[model samples]
Target: MGKEHVIHTDGACRNNGRDNPQGAIGVHSERGSISERLPASMERHTNNMAEHAAINRGLKSAPYDNNPVVIKTDSELCQKTFGGGWAQQWERNGGRTAGGSKPANYDFVQDTMKEVNYRRSQGQDVRFEHVRGHAGDSGNQRAHDLAQQGLGQGAPQYKYGGRY
Candidate 1:
């Protein structure tokens, strides 16, 4: 087992659920970093959606060959939904909540699960950890700043491995 990549991700939404709402995702790693505002088609209008998108983007940016990838995020919702058993139970229950209601952010959760499963299929050890937001951690701070800046930025760009 070699050095695993530690990716710190964050998301932000301006005026969520209001007119002209905007959301963005930020990802940071030792290889490089990405700070991109999500697209309209993604229809991400909430903070949690932005957070999930960041995770999805981070997972996609990382190569399947990179084993033991650790994703650190400030959103506990992400940790609970993906890393916790809630997502598994949801899948078992046909995407329904324990109360038999359609869960919120189903699309985001599904997309993230696909990424997680894909990494596992490639023999990668993927894990998620929750970090306190704005707690002075350098990686978390970078990601947080980028996510906030993305609220008014142009299309997002990825700089992973100096490729894209």
Candidate 2:
């Protein structure tokens, strides 16, 4: 993890359908290309899920163990989800029925949280950083592009790993 291991990850869902969902991670060793498209986990747009998927996949693909991870995402919800702390205020007060809370969606967020917690327990040095996506962040932009492509058809090919 010598030259700033930057992991840029993102997920995409088209029209609330994950039929062809995708999550791409760009692992940059000092800003040079090392982009890889990770397999998707359920779809349907939720800025939080996309952001979480990216961070999870990106960190999981780091080259060195226990290395620092810098997750660049555009979703604030994604940031709060992984950065630790409380869930949405409404959810915290058992108001899953209000303020964007839907009975069908909370499950995925909960499941993702479990996975994220497991990863943390495994001694992974993870940190979530926000980047204004689509603002020309190369890795982030590439990830989003790949995700949209994945949403179309044929699972995206990994530019770095995942074939093994």
Candidate 3:
């Protein structure tokens, strides 16, 4: 086992067919500074998609060790889906709707959940923690800002390092 850590991720989709989309990931030591890790883009997408990508990227950035992780995010949907373990059901069904149809955001949700659970199985204590946005949470704020910036016509850094 090793020391635990904290990670915060955020994403944004500026507009569809009119604006670009972006995702950002921020990581912090349980005891110190935060790291901003993610790439922003100007591609068409939805906020949900960006948010999911942020969580996925954050999970991937975490080290695979027997250490606990506190994954922070501003997306309530993302938090609940991962924390409640319901994301598994969505994945097991191949991102399909219960009515034998297709869900709008089922694919990414299922894929991301699979990755999150996989990380957990690899000894990484990847726990989802919900955080309020624009309420003086430095890490969350930075991630949000980065996500917005990522919706530009350029590439942004996916990882950032600093104290929250």
TM for every model, in the order presented, reads: 0.89, 0.59, 0.72
Can you write out model 1's per-residue Cα lDDT over 1-164, one digit (the tens) per residue? Answer: 77898899998899898887788888898878888887776653788878887887787777667568889999999998888878889999999999999878787778778778877887888899999998888999998888887877665643222212
Cα miss at 119, model 2 (Å)? Answer: 6.2
Better of 2 and 3 by lDDT: 3
Model 2 misses residue 101 by how many Å? 7.4
Best by TM-score: 1
Clashing pairs in 1: 36-156, 158-164
Can you write out model 2's per-residue Cα lDDT over 5-61, one digit (the tens) per residue?
Answer: 566666654443435444443333344443344444443444455455555556555
In model 1, state the lDDT of residue 11: 89
Give the lowest summed-lDDT range of ten residues in model 1. 155-164
Highest lDDT scorer: 1
Greater TM-score among 2 and 3 belongs to: 3
- Give the alpha carbon lDDT tens digit for every residue of 121-161 in model 3: 87666788889988999888877766665655555454322
